[model samples]
Target: MSRFRYSFQKIVDLKTNEKTQAEWILSSAVNDLRVEEDQLSDLKHHKSEVQETLVSAAANRTTVSELMLYQKYLDHIDHQILNKNAAVRAAQINVEDKQSNLTAKMREEKVWSKAREKAKLHFTAALLKKDQEALDEMSVSRHKQPS
Candidate 1:
């Protein structure tokens, strides 16, 4: 009997590779989003600490210039936090896109895999049938011969 060969093995491999690449892209985007979120958290923590210091200084009769400087610094940190939030949002979107692409590639690969499995089953059935026929012929020949 002839060996079973999958006709679309190459296509399956290609789709698997594409899925791997998309997974990598998604991982990178997720990592980037995490980093941006961490930075934003740190900035917010620092702003709170500065605010507390400013309140203590005001109670201790701090100069107007110093108070103004602290307020300006707080505003700057707020702006940075806003920008970081936007960056995190953009990274999230990128990860979602990559995830979608990976899903598509995986689905394509599964289709080819199913086709290969069907072909193998058909080949096996044919081989079994051929073997059964050969056995039947040999048995009939033996019975026809002299006992």
Candidate 2:
């Protein structure tokens, strides 16, 4: 048997809260992903600055106390950077999950649309066939001798 192929012909007819929610979810997910990426960029820039500071401190051969203070500052910056990176990663994961859900929703919508089109076509063809059958019967009866 040949595999069935389907396509949408009346996607415009569907109106439901689910479709509206899907659109909103997709838009929000995209916006959230963008914001997370921007935060990551800012965090990396800050981390780079801290690294530069550490490198300069090392090169200067500062006194022990000053070096210790610099090390503490560097450590604090590193912690903040790590925290920022973690937050960004978590946000990215959330965005990816939401995107996956959105993709599934879109697929569902496509399938539903195709099914609806097929149903419409099937009903229309059936009605046409019924009308044709009726016309054929009427013509045969009209020409037949009384019986």
Candidate 3:
């Protein structure tokens, strides 16, 4: 029997490549999200430490200027936290979008793979039928010959 070749083999390969690329994109997005989340956590931790220091200063013999400075610093930290939160949100949205794209690519790949399998099965069945016909013809020719 001849080698079975899928007519859409190129399409199947392209679909698989697309899926792999999508997976890589999704991985990158996830890494970005993780980095953003870690930065936000660090910012919150720093803000807490500053707040504690400000409180301690207030309870001690700190001057008004120092207190005002601490307050301003706290305000600055708050603004940074807000911006970091926004960044985290945006990264999360990016991850979601990448996840959606990866899902689509995977589906496309599966469709092409299934089609290839179906085509291969058809090819095998046809080959088997041809072989069986050849065998039957040979058997009939032997029966018709003199013993």
User: TM-score for every candidate vs. truth?
Assistant: 0.91, 0.64, 0.97
Candidate 2 lDDT, tens digit per residue, 29-101?
7787778778768777876887777678878877778778877877877777787778778777877887777
Per-candidate RMSD, Å: 1.5, 7.0, 0.8
Residue 10 of candidate 1: its Cα lDDT? Answer: 88
By lDDT: ranked, best first: 3, 1, 2
Across residues 22-67, which tens digit of lDDT does each residue of candidate 1 receive? 8888888889888888988998899899999989988998899999
Select the stronger candidate by lDDT from 1 and 3.
3
For candidate 3, report its TM-score: 0.97
Instruction: Give the count of colliding residue pairs in each prediction.
Output: 0, 0, 0
List runs of model 3 lying over 4 Å from the truth.
none
Model 3 — which ten-residue stretch has the worst lDDT?
Answer: 1-10
Regions of candidate 1 where Cα sits further than 4 Å from its true position: none
Question: Candidate 2: how many backbone clashes?
Answer: 0
Clash count, predicted structure 3: 0
Better of 1 and 2 by TM-score: 1
Please name the candidate that would achieve the greatest lDDT relative to the true structure. 3
